[model samples]
Target: MSQFPPPLRQPEAERNPLPVPRPMSGRKVLLAVLAGLVLGWMIGMFMESIVANTPNDIDPDELHRLRWLLAAAGALSGLAIESIRQLQAASTDPAYRRRRRFRP
Candidate 1:
């Protein structure tokens, strides 16, 4: 006599999974890019304000350097924001959830 119950069988359709989801549409990509740019620009402006309000004197050369630094910071922040948006989108996707369930 078998001590354990037999394994339940699932339908063929359930056994064979569908292909992974396709890439994001162009519109979504564009939107994500635009959102990131806006966020980065806002942060850059805030940083500039902080620098402007400092008590110490700032030289013309220092001001030029600050502009470059601010630009780079803004670009990097924009990239980070875009990545976060992508991550959130993926997490909420039903296909993504299904794929995750099958992963180790």
Candidate 2:
């Protein structure tokens, strides 16, 4: 019998051979959501004001619906913008390099 014991298992990083995703912090997520909410609220208020001042007559229900739509659009835009920024940052980060890295 050999005197030496069996070799220990390789580390997970070496064994997996896959790049692990860096975890995002809660603060970043919370800030993104807050930004979206604020943008949505501001857009809603602005649209409501414009609708209120329009010369042409609009139905009350229609105006309310329009306001909600505008707010929703703004919120979605904010979220999209935040996501893009995060993705860009991640791609540029020096830690991990992949073949599909984003350009421009």
TM per prediction = 0.46, 0.53
Q: Worst 10-residue stretch by lDDT in candidate 1?
A: 92-101
Question: Which candidate achieves the best lDDT against the true structure?
Answer: 2
Residues 1-104 of candidate 1: C-alpha lDDT, one tens digit per residue: 99999999999978965555455455665566566556656665676678779987767577656666666665566566666666656564555555444556
The candidate scoring highest on TM-score is: 2
Candidate 2, residue 95: how far the Cα is off, in Å = 14
Encode model 2's per-residue lDDT on 1-104: one tens digit a residue. Answer: 99999999999868866444455555675577667767777777787788789888878788778767766776677667777666655564555454576899
Q: Which residues of candidate 2, in runs, are more than 4 Å off?
A: 1-21, 92-104
TM-score of 2: 0.53
CA lDDT of each prediction against the hidden true structure: 0.63, 0.69
Off by over 4 Å in 1: 1-11, 14-16, 59-104
